[model samples]
Target: MENLPYGALAALVGLSGGLVLGLAARLGDFCTLGALESSIYGGDHRRLRLWGIVLGTAIAGCYLAQAAGYIDLSQTLYQSVRWNPWASIVGGLVFGYGMALAGNCGFGALARFGGGDLRSLVVVVVMAVFSFITLNGPLAPLRITLFPQIGAESSQNYADLISGLTGLPPLAIALPVAVLCFAWALSYAPLRRSPRRLVWGLLAGLAVVWAFVGTAWLADQSFGEVAIEGPSFTAPLGRTLIYLMTSTAGGITFSVGSVIGVMAGAFIGSSIRGLFRWEACEDPRELGRQVTGAALMGIGGVVALGCSVGQGVSAFATLAYSGPVTLACIGAGAVLGLRHLIGGFQPG
Candidate 1:
């Protein structure tokens, strides 16, 4: 494994996990917006509970992996970057509102595109472009000036904080929290009844852990471009697009493989389910709204440091402070956006 090209190994690792995510999205109907809509408007908790399973499983797997010395949390970007509350709130809210307008987050857009929704391709392209603009384009200077992503003075990791506070190993604290979440998810009888959803949720979480473990190993074996990371669509999508245009100069990376893997997996899943078909936006007004939403998602995701799956699941696995705060803001923003859509934002 050490002799393998770091970039190639990372891409393969990302591709393998992304395939699992893509299949889950298409067949299991695993989606953040869908879950929020179903739980809020449709009076259903199954999808939300499914999300819980994914979170719990991710937390448990990541912590356990660290305990086994399979990965190093400090090396991951999530842990290295300073946790900015303002950035999290502003970015999460913008991203959430954008998701409501676009009808999907970046990850969801990719998954939808894979299922033959050509409209989603527009969102994906716009989102990726805007993400790059904010991440490294002209906006980068302003973003850095305002948000200044420096490493935390004190360790920003939850596990580290707990370990220091209580003099208990971080794993000791993490395992219990993970178990509690898993228990809550399992407590929902409806979710348990649908074994397929449960399996997919678990697999999605495991995918995050697997990415960290694989990438960490590569980095340890050969210190190169390999950065310990997991699934995140915002910057990755932009990087993938750039790589496509400049193949000679650009090297394949985990992000590139993850993006391709999701589409490929979604394609397979859709084909298997006989749900593959060509679809496009026929309404100009709808297209306009999606483009606006996509732009917001791209900028917001970059500012927030991640989209839903990025912070909500992947960062959460690392127990980063930004995860829960950003996720809460996103959920709140989604609720507000949903209300505006459903009831014209008028209060009773």
Candidate 2:
């Protein structure tokens, strides 16, 4: 049974995720950072609040999924406390700033690719490559060398800090608070007026969360089956690149499946909606933004161990102690970038 053909199964899950992403992209137009930025500038509450509503739905869906036995989140890697705590927060901050600059995060970049955006192509390529470099390329040794040497013992992880502060199990405080915060965010009265967008936003949010949960599950089924489960990008991106370079005895990797499915799904969904617009950067400054944003995302993603979708949404719903901390730092970083570099880009 262990040797059974699970490759197709894995691909199917990945394809479903991509289709969900493309459908959401073509439908809801949800991206929190972008939506927030747009709101700040245009004073339009539609997209911004839609982002929040999506988040609320994602949180609710995640909890429901876990309760339904779709995922035993305790098996997730986020619970492991061996890594540097400061890294997640610091990395999230930098990644958030970079996301603002690139005008997209990991998921956002993938969604934009469906729209035939060439500038995003550049950003995604650089991000994937640099992600490889940081996780395993020439930079790997340097990361191992610098990480322990830089942060204090106190810089372990957000959960450690929370446990220290509240004297309770991290999950005890994190889960309840996350649910409450999401509920408050979604309860914005004006947003309830548009039921169509509300339904789309909720579905989009669930699609993203459950997609990763499925990825982790697929990975577990790939071999003799391991109990450990996690959804992260830094190492997975590097591994996916390596898999592309050479075929080996290692099991099927879900990241590769997920990445491929997004392109295919985007192609199909865009064609269906007649929203296929091939885009390129006309302004030279846009090129600079892409390069800078890509580099920042690569480095920051490695340090934080995830992009926005990975940490902010996916990991957060699991009630992982680090999730909230990383999200807050990421948001703060985005706020900083908007204040200093892209002040003209505001969120309503």
Candidate 3:
């Protein structure tokens, strides 16, 4: 432990949590767009309800760790960055629509790529390139001009805000919200029957908590050299690419570890399920659509400051204001995109 660099330690922490997330996505069918599509068009709510379990467990675990002094929520970008409602709404909508067209988010693309889907490899690369374009490339200036992300005066989250209002401890508000989420998930008989799915959901949530706690500890040990962060696929995807391209210039970090871990875990999960098969986009039109969608996702994710799993799960675990609002907008945008694709926009 002493011999390993602080960056390596952070990478290890990210790897551990990311592996669990990847496993959850593959083995448990825990996916953002898939859930929405299933619930809305497929007439199945079990996958959608699984979100309750994930959110409930994450919320509980994070707050519990906070109370125990294992992690500080304020260090996270979700809390540190000033809340931007317009950014959340607009970025989320774009990301969601792109997700619908591409058929995957960054995380999902990585997972599918791991499962030997060559098409997902395209999505991943395109998304990564565009993410960098928006994050630090040409579009960065425009994004900043439109949605300037300044530092917050203090930590910003639901628990903090509600606590301020009620004069109660943050834990007092967080635990009940967690309980409500669990209750909502368990209310679905189908989801309740699937203990495997439930277990994976719980593990998925715990992964987010693990990311924060592990990164927090590393940040302390490194005297702030290491940043406190959770799993976020958007910018991380770009970071991973940079690291891969310039190993000598770029040092190993959490983002690299996380991106690799997801693919590794997804491969394992795919092998276990006998789902590993080489696949590719045979349709030029489909490929074009996917590339375009990936570009949109990259740009939107940068503007929003997180992707679906990033905001929907990791940020939400911290009870950040950006989490729920961004998630809702993503869902709405995905629905609109899906409707358009399915000819629901045919003068109806």
Best by TM-score: 3
**Error at 27, model 3, angstroms:** 0.8
Instruction: List, residue by residue over 1-348, the lDDT tens digit for candidate 1.
Output: 657678888999999999999998988889999999999889988988888889899999998999999988877878888889999999999999888888899899999999999999999999999999998899999999988898756677888998998999989988888988888889999999999999989999998899989899888877646888889999899988988899733588899989999999899989999999999999887788788888888988999999999999999889999898888888887777777767753222
Off by over 4 Å in 2: 1-4, 81-83, 148-182, 212-252, 343-348
Q: Per-prediction TM-score, please?
A: 0.96, 0.79, 0.98
TM-score ranking, high to low:
3, 1, 2
- Tens digits of lDDT, candidate 3, 1-348: 889999999999989888998898889988999999999989989899999999999999999999999998988999999999999999999999999888899999999999999999999999999999998899999999999999999768999999999999999999999999999999999999999899999999999899999999999998998888989999899889888998843589999988999999899998999999999899887888789888889999999989998898888999999999999989998888888879833221
The runs of at least 3 residues in candidate 3 whose Cα sits more than 4 Å from the true structure, single-residue gaps closed, are 248-250, 344-348
lDDT of 2 by residue, 1-348 (tens): 355456545555656665665566566666657776777777767766775665666655665666566765555556544455687777888888887787777667776787798888788777878887887678878866765433232323344367688897644544565566556556776667767667767776676666656755765665424323333444455555566777543445556666666666667767877888999999877778777877788888887767776676666666555676777887788777777665464321
Q: Ten residues in a row with the worst lDDT in model 2?
A: 148-157
Q: lDDT, candidate 2, residue 158?
A: 46
Ranking by lDDT: 3, 1, 2
Best by lDDT: 3
State each model's CA lDDT, in order.
0.88, 0.65, 0.91
